[model samples]
Target: MTQHHQPAPAPAPAFAHAQDGTALAYQHRGQGPPLVLLAGQANDHHWWDGVREDFHTVRSTITLDLRGTGDSDKPEGPYSIDQFADDVVAVLNALGIERADVYGTSMGGRVAQSLAIRHPERIRRLVLGCTSPGGPHAVERDASVRRSLAQPDPQAVRRALADLMYSPHWQAAHPGPYRTLGDPRMPAHARRAHLIASNGHDAWSELPRVAAPTLILHGDQDRLTPPDNLPLLASRIPGARTHLFPGARHAYFEECREEAGTLVREFLLEEG
Candidate 1:
């Protein structure tokens, strides 16, 4: 009989906390200026696993699983963007960080915007990746997509993950990570809560209040938050700039991690 071999399992990430005692999870890597990364909706801190190595070349990186997701505490609904922003501040405080650059994606971008607006003292610079100001134009996800997300069917969830995260060619050539996105641990309630936070968010008027130097990154091929939205965001915030990644989708960071990290590192290092 032939001998069989099994692959070793990946090590699980670490956990931390916000000042409010809400359990939060995060993975820390690298060794320089701190850069706190807030991940997109329905995802965990591990979402940054692919890019963490790249970021370490420039600065220390911390990627947190926001409250109610991944290894974090799943406090009941009624969660708001403000609450999430506070969570970021609390985490910074708990870590004894006076200030750090912030990078957020999708829903995470909204939270980063809120942090800049409400807790400007904590943020040194801001990077908004594949996100939009929650307004009329931001409501671009198709009704069928919304319906499928609402149903909580396993197959539907898998398809939705692929549609949101990758281009057709990428999906066809590499489907493993996309399929793992439907891991049973991601509950319907968490998805609903994330949607509630995204839909209820209205940061358009608050854009002008963001004082930190900001960089808005958008994918030209992003279906969820269209590229047009990036200009609107750039125009509103003082000293805000925008970048469009060609042939990239909403998961621009995952698809172009090194390029994105390079852009972000250069932007954050710029002196005003």
Candidate 2:
């Protein structure tokens, strides 16, 4: 069967972060209230490149390359979701932001959840995209897929991940840009570290404690986390609302950028 796809959008501006004197790199754009973005495992802020402008239209957007990805420092092992959440807190602290809306995708979503659970006062609103409640059901990625990502050959890995990242229709519609964004030279150790931290995460038990208003977005066709995860996540977080896009995949933000941005803006505005 044939599928439909949306045209891809252009990239946004780049921003640098003096994260605790570490010089972390990020992308900043948009205007209005501050909205921080977190990327997925084995991906950097570049994952948001296509959707940053859309987000900026409604609110000031900040997208970061976490410690080990993009141009950020890739320190050795012992990486935990909580530690990554601290890195996010450091970014906000360095920028003198006491509180702001937070949006996280996949691993980034995990970080956002952790931040909300551990440091509730710092988050004004929360958006978890293409994410799962970290537990048994979440650790079901195909073995071959896991193996490829663990020790990926840059080019081959990018190609392999492309299939998992976007819907088939979206892939066909914007093949060039998707391929380019996926071509970064991610190391095996870094990928493994991220996977370990993400899979080891278990925040479902603590999610009900989050006080911030929350929004959960997921793609119906997302093979990575599966749409079922969205309901699970929303159920765990009190008062959390969810939106599932039909025919979308793991990169739902990119595939449905405009819709996603609109939903997020409306949710924040109504809740605030």
Judging by lDDT against the true structure, name the best candidate: 2
lDDT of 2 at 121: 93
Of candidate 2, the 10-residue stretch with the lowest lDDT total is: 1-10
Candidate 2 clashes: the total is 0
How much is 142 displaced in model 1, in angstroms? 3.1
Best by TM-score: 1
Candidate 1 residue-wise lDDT at 196: 87
List the candidates' TM-scores in order.
0.88, 0.86
Over 103-157, each residue of candidate 2 has an lDDT whose tens digit, in order, gives: 9988889999999999999999999998887887453566776676556366676
Candidate 1, clashing residue pairs?
Answer: none
RMSD of 1: 5.3
